[model samples]
Target: MAQTDVDSRNAQFWDELCGSGLARSLGITENTPESLQKFDHAYMGMYPYLQPYVTDEDLAGRKVMEIGLGYGTLGQLIASRGCLYHGLDIAPGPVAMMRYRLEFLGQDLGDRIRQGSALEIPWPDASFDCVYSIGCLHHTGNLPRAVAEVHRVLVPGGKAIVMLYHRHSLRQVIQIPVRYVRDRLSGRRRFASFGEAARAYYDTNAQGEAAPHTDVVSRAQVRQSLFRQFSRVRIDSQNFDTYVLLRGRIVIPRERFLNNLARVLGTDLNIVATK
Candidate 1:
C-alpha cells in the first residue's frame, strides 16, 4: 500500500477501536472492573525486571508520559509513586474509563489523561522527564517516527521504556496457527470491527477476527531505533505462557515452561533508552 494509504488505514483503525462500544460489550463497567485491573497488574508486575536497572526514586517528582494508556493501570501505578503521570491513548473509551476509575480511586490527577496519538503527541520538546510506551508502538505504521517522537519529548537526561512484540517468541509461534484456522472458519468478507474483535476474544480463545497484527521488530531493529536517538540502551525479554487444550476445556501447565522458554527464546523485548 501507498504510504498515505497506510497512514489513513491505521488512523481509521485506531479511531474505530477507540470509538467502538466494545468496552461496554465486554462488561468492563465500574462494577466489574477487576478483569481490566488484573491485566494491568500483570503488565506492571514485569516492571521489576526493568526496575533493577532503573529505580522509582529516579522517577519521583519527574514528569512521566505513557503512550497508549490501556485501562489506566500503569498510569495509576505511576501516580501512586508520586510521579506526574500524563497518559494518552487513541481510544476515547479507554481514556474516559481510566479517568472515571482513577477518580473513584481518589487519584483524580486532573488533566493528566488525554486522547492522542503516539506518532503525533501534542506536547513540546523536552516536556517530559520520562516517556514510555508499553505494547503500543508496534501498532503504528511508522514505528521509527514514533520512537523519534518519544525521544523528542524527553528531557536531556530523561528515560524511556518501550515494549514491542517479539517475532521470535513462543507466543507468536502458537498464535499464528490459531489465527489461521480462525480466519478460514469465519469466512467473513471484511475485517471485524473493534467491538466484534473484543467479543470474539472474550467468547472464543481466538484473535483472528481482530485487526491484523502489524509489523514485528527484531532485537537488532529495536536496538538500532533506540540507539540512534538516545545515549544508553538495553534490551531484555519477558514471557507469558497462555494456552488451552481440548478447545479451552483443558488447561496447560506451561507457565514454568514458558518462563524458561522466554529465557531461552529471548522473547518479549524491552528496551530502556536514556535521552
Candidate 2:
C-alpha cells in the first residue's frame, strides 16, 4: 500500500478504537481522582518493560510534551513531578477522560492535554524543553516524518526520549506467528480492555489490539532517524527475561535476576536524542 493510504488507515483505526468506548470498559473514568492513583500502580507494575530510560528527575520543571497519551497515565506522573505536561493523542475519548480525571484531582491540567495528531503536531518550532513519545511513534505510517516532527518541536539543547519496538528481539520473533493464529481463532477483531489485551499477550503470545500498527525497527535505523535532527543520541534496550517470565507466569525467585538479564539482552529499544 502507498504511504498516504497507510497513514489514512492508521488514523481511521485509532479513531474507531477510541470511539468504541473501550477506554471506559477498561475502568478508565472521566471524573475520578483515584483513577490517576490506580493508573500509577498499573504503570509501576509494568515498569520492568519501561523503566530503563526513565529517571526520577527527568520531569522536574521541564516543559514536556508526551505523544500518544494513552489514559494520560504517564502525563499525570510527569505532572506530579513538577514538569509542565502537554499530552497529545489522536483519540478524543482518552483526552476527555484525562481532562476530567485531572480536573477531579484538583489539578488544572486539562489544557495541557489536547486531541492532536502525532504526525502533525499543533505547536510552534522550538516550543518545548523536552518531547517524548512512548510506544507511539511506531504507530505512525511515516515513522521518519514523525521523528522529524518531534525534532522540530524541541528547543535547542532540548531532549526527547522515544521508545519503539525492537525488530530483532527474541520475544517478537516468537510472538508474531502466535498472534496470527490467535487472531484467526478468536473471531473478535480487536481487544476491548487492557486486562483482556494483557491476557491475550500472555496466553497467545500476541500483541492483540496493539498489533495492528506495531512496527519493529532496527537499532541502527532508530539511531539514524534520531541523528538526522539531534546532536546527541543514545540507544538502550530493556525487558529481557523478566518480560518473558512475567508473560509466561513463571514463578521466578529473584526479581533482580530478570533486571540483570534485561541489562544484558537489551530487548525494548529506547532512543534518547538532544536537539
Candidate 3:
C-alpha cells in the first residue's frame, strides 16, 4: 500500500479507538483526574521498564518531543518533570486526550500538542534535544523514513528513545505459528501463510480489526538501516508474557527463568540512540 493510504488508514483506526481501546477495560471510563490516575497505574503495571528507561530526572529541563500521545500518560509525565513537552499524533483523539490531560493538571501545554504523521514530523531541523517514541514508529509503514525524520529534528548529540517490535520475539517465533495453524484449521480466516497470519495478529486490536501497517525488525536490521544515522545505538529486548507458550492460560512457574528468557525473546526492542 502507498504511504499516504497507510497513514490515512492508521489515522482513522486510532481516531476511532484511542489508545488501543484498552482504557475502558482498565477502569478508565471517563476523562477525569481519577480515570487518568488509574490509567497511569495500569500502564506502569503493564510496562514497568518505562519508568526507569524514560527517567524524569534526566529529562528535567530538556526540550523533549514525544511522537505519540497514547492516553497522554508519558506526555503528562514529561511536562510535569519541567521539560518543554511537545507532542504529535496521527489522530485527533489522542492529541485531544493529551491536551485535555495537560489542561486538567493545570500545565496549560495544550498548544504544544498537534495531530500529524510520523513520516513527516512538522518540526524544524535541530529543533529538539530529545525525541521519544514508544510502540509508535513501527506502525508508521516507513520505519526508515520515520527514523530519518527523527534524526533530522534532533540536535547533534541529542537522544532518542524508541520502542519497536522485535521480529525474533517469542510471540513471533512460537505463538504466531501455532495461532496460524489453529486459525487455519478452524476456518476463521483464510491465511495464505504464516507471514500473513503474523502480520494480521500483530496489527490486530482488541476489536479484532487489523491496523493499516505494523513492522517488526531484528537488532541488526535496526542498526544497519533504521538508525544508521545515529552515532550510538543500544537495543534491549524486554516485555514478555510468562505463559506465552500456553496463551496465558497458566502462569509460568519460574520468575528468574522468565526474566532471563525475556532478555533475548521479549517482544519490545527498546532502542536508545544518540544522534
Candidate 4:
C-alpha cells in the first residue's frame, strides 16, 4: 500500500477510536478537568513507571514536544510543569482533543499543537530540547524515518524519550501464539504468520479496531538501526498486567519475582536517547 493510503487509514482508525474511548466506556465520558484528571489517574495507575521519567528536573522550562497526544493526559502533565509544551498527532481527533484539554487547563498553546505524521515532523531542525512519545512510534509505518524526524527536531544533546513495543516480549513470545491459535480455531481471523498475528493482536485496541500499521522492535534493532544518530541510548522494559491495579497501587501477585521478570520480558520498551 502507498504511504499516503496507510497514513489516511491510520488517521481514520484513530479518529474513530480515540484514545479516551476506553475511559469513556469506564464512565469517564466528559472532557472536563475532573474527567481528565480521572483519566490521568487511571492511566498513571496502570503504568506507574511513566511519571518518573517526565519530571521537573528534565522537562521544566525546556521546549518539549510530544508526538502523540493520547487524550492529552501526558500533554497536560507536561504543560503543567512550566515547559514550553508542544504536541503533534497524525490524526486530527487527538489534536483537537488536546487543544481543548490545554485550553481548559488555562495553557492554551494555539498553533503549537498540530496534526502531522511522525515520519515527517512539522518542525524545523533543532526545534526542541526534548521529544517525547509513548506507544506512538511503533504505530508509524516507517519507524526509522520517524526516529530520524525526532532526531532532527531535537537540538544537539537533546533527548528523545520514547516507548516502542518490544519484539521479544513475553506477550509476543507466548501470549500471541496462544491467542493466535485460539483466534484461528474460533474463526475470529486467520493470520498468515506469527508476525502477522502479533501485529494484529497489538494493533487491536480496547475498541476492537486495529490500527493501520504497527511494528515491534528489539533493543538491539533500536540502538543499531533506528537511533544510530544518537550519541547515547538506553532502553528498559516495563509492563504490568492491568489486573494488578488495586486502587491506585500496582499489587502484583509475586511483586518482586514478576517485576524482575517483567524487566527482562516486558512488552513496553522505554527508550531514552541523546542526540
Candidate 5:
C-alpha cells in the first residue's frame, strides 16, 4: 500500500482502538489503588520486559515519553511513578481518550498526551530522559524515521526501550505453508519458494494488529537500521512460541519440548539502547 493509504488506515484503526475500552478489559475500573494494582499485575505478566527495563529510577522525577499509548494503561503507570509522562499517538482519538481515562481514574498527568507521529516527534531535541515504545514502530509508515526520532528526543545519556515484530519466528514458519497454499490458489507469483512466500506475507500482512501496514525484521535489521544513534544497544527475543496439541476436548502437553523451544526463539524483538 502507498504511504498515504497506510496513513489513512492507521488513523482509522487507532480511532477505533480508543473506544475499545482495553483498560476495563484488564479489570482496572474507576476504583482507586486496588484496581490499578490489578491492572499493573496483568500488564506486567503479559509484557515482563517493562518490569526490569523501565525501573523506578528511570521514572522518578524524569521526563518519560511513551510513543504509543495503547489503552492508557502505560500512561497511568508512567505517571504514577512520579515522572512527567508525555504520551504520543498518531491518531488524536487515542490521545484524547488516554488523557480522559487517566484523569477519570484520579491520576494527575500534568500535561495531556500529545497527538502526533513518531516519524516526526512533535517535541524538541533531547526532550526526554527515557523513551519507550512497545509493539508500535513496525506499523509506522517509516520505521527507521520513527526510531531516529526516539533517539533525537532523548537526552545525551537517555535510554529507549523498543519492541518490534521478529522476522525469524514460529509465526513466520507457520505462515510460510499457509501463504504458499494461498498464493498457489490465488495465482500470485510473489515468492520463489514457500520460505520466501512466508517471509513476504509476514512482512506485509498486519496479523490482526490495529494497523493495515506492518513489517517484521530480524535482530540485525533492528540493530543496524534502528539503533544507530545509541552508544550501546542490546537486542533480545521474547514471547517464545510453544507447540500445542488438542484432541477432542482434552489438551495434550509438550511442556518439556516447548520450554526448550521458547528458551531460544521468541516472536518479539526487544531493543534496549542508550544515546
Candidate 6:
C-alpha cells in the first residue's frame, strides 16, 4: 500500500518548498557538473559525511535506494557511482524536479523517482542492498514505522544509512523559546512534557510555515525506536551552528566560534545500521 494518510499540511508545505525552488535557495544554478559540485560543497559543508559514503567504491553496481531526493545532487552522485538508484519522496514536486534533473543528466530516471511516503515504501521485501535516508525520516507522520520499513526492504546483511535531528543539539536549544512563543501566540496553553515541548521546538518554522512533522529524536530514541531491529548500529553527528533561524530566511551565516561550538553540540544523528 502507498501510505496515503500523511498530514495534508506536510504535503502542502513540501509543495510550497518545491514551487519556491529548493535548489535555488542553496545556490544550485544549472544542471551541470560544476553546479552539482557547487551544491555538493554547500551541502557537504552542512552534512560533511555525505560525499565519502555516496562516492565510495562499494556503491558501484550495488542496488541502492535513497529515501529523500533533495535537489537531486546526491542522487546524481549516486547514479554516477554506478548504483542502481531508486528515490522516494512524499511530495510530487520534488519527484518531478528530480525526474527533470535526471533527464537533463542524459540518463532518464523514467520511474526511478516516485511520489511515495517513507512510512510504507512501495517496494518488495528484501529487495535492496542498501537503503539511505538523510535528514528526512524524522519529518514523517510515523517515524518508527518508517524505520521499520527501512529494515524490512533491505536484504539480509544490507545496510540502512539514515540521518535524524538530535534532541540535545544547539538547533533544538535555539528553537525552544521560539516554539514556546509561537505556540503561545497560537493559543496553546502548556506543554505536556519536556520531550513534547522539544518536539514542538523542532517543528517550529520562523519563515512563514513549515511541514507538520519536523521532529527531533534522541540517541536513546534511535536505539529504541529508529534502529531497534538492526543487528549493528553506529551513530554519529555533524553541523552545529552554521546557520541561525530568522524571518524571511531560516538560515543565516554565523561566526566561526558558534559553528565550532555546534561541533561540540552536534545537531544530526548519522545512523548506519546493518539489517
The lDDT for every candidate, in the order shown, is 0.65, 0.65, 0.82, 0.82, 0.70, 0.71
Clashing pairs in 5: none
lDDT for each residue of candidate 5 in 35-98, tens digit (9 for 90 to 100)? 6557657766656656666654558888889987865666666666877778989887768756
Task: Tell me the tens digit of each residue's lDDT in model 4 across 1-275.
Answer: 68899888888777643455558666975677787778888887667788877873467779999998878777888888889999998888888888888887687586899999999998899999999999998887888899999999999999999999988887878788887888888987756666666776666655565677888899899989999889999999988443345565866453343457779888789999999
Better of 1 and 5 by TM-score: 5
Error of 2 at 93 (Å): 1.8
What is the C-alpha lDDT profile of model 2 across 144-186, one tens digit per residue?
8888899889999998888876777655665555565577588
Select the stronger candidate by TM-score from 1 and 3: 3
Per-residue lDDT tens digits for candidate 6, residues 204-236, read 333534446666778888888678899999887
Q: Report RMSD (Å) for each prediction in the order shown.
A: 5.5, 5.9, 2.4, 3.9, 5.2, 5.2
TM-score on alpha carbons, each prediction: 0.72, 0.73, 0.91, 0.89, 0.76, 0.77
Error of 3 at 131 (Å): 0.5
Worst 10 residues of 1 by lDDT: 198-207
Error of 2 at 192 (Å): 20
In candidate 4, list every pair of residues with a backbone clash.
none
Worst 10 residues of 3 by lDDT: 250-259
Error of 4 at 157 (Å): 0.8
Poorest stretch of ten by lDDT in candidate 5: 202-211
Question: Which model is ahead, 1 or 2, in terms of TM-score?
Answer: 2
Question: Whole-model lDDT, candidate 4?
Answer: 0.82
lDDT of 3 by residue, 91-170 (tens): 98888888887886677574678889888898889999999999899889899999999999999999899999999998
Which of 3 and 6 is the better model by lDDT?
3
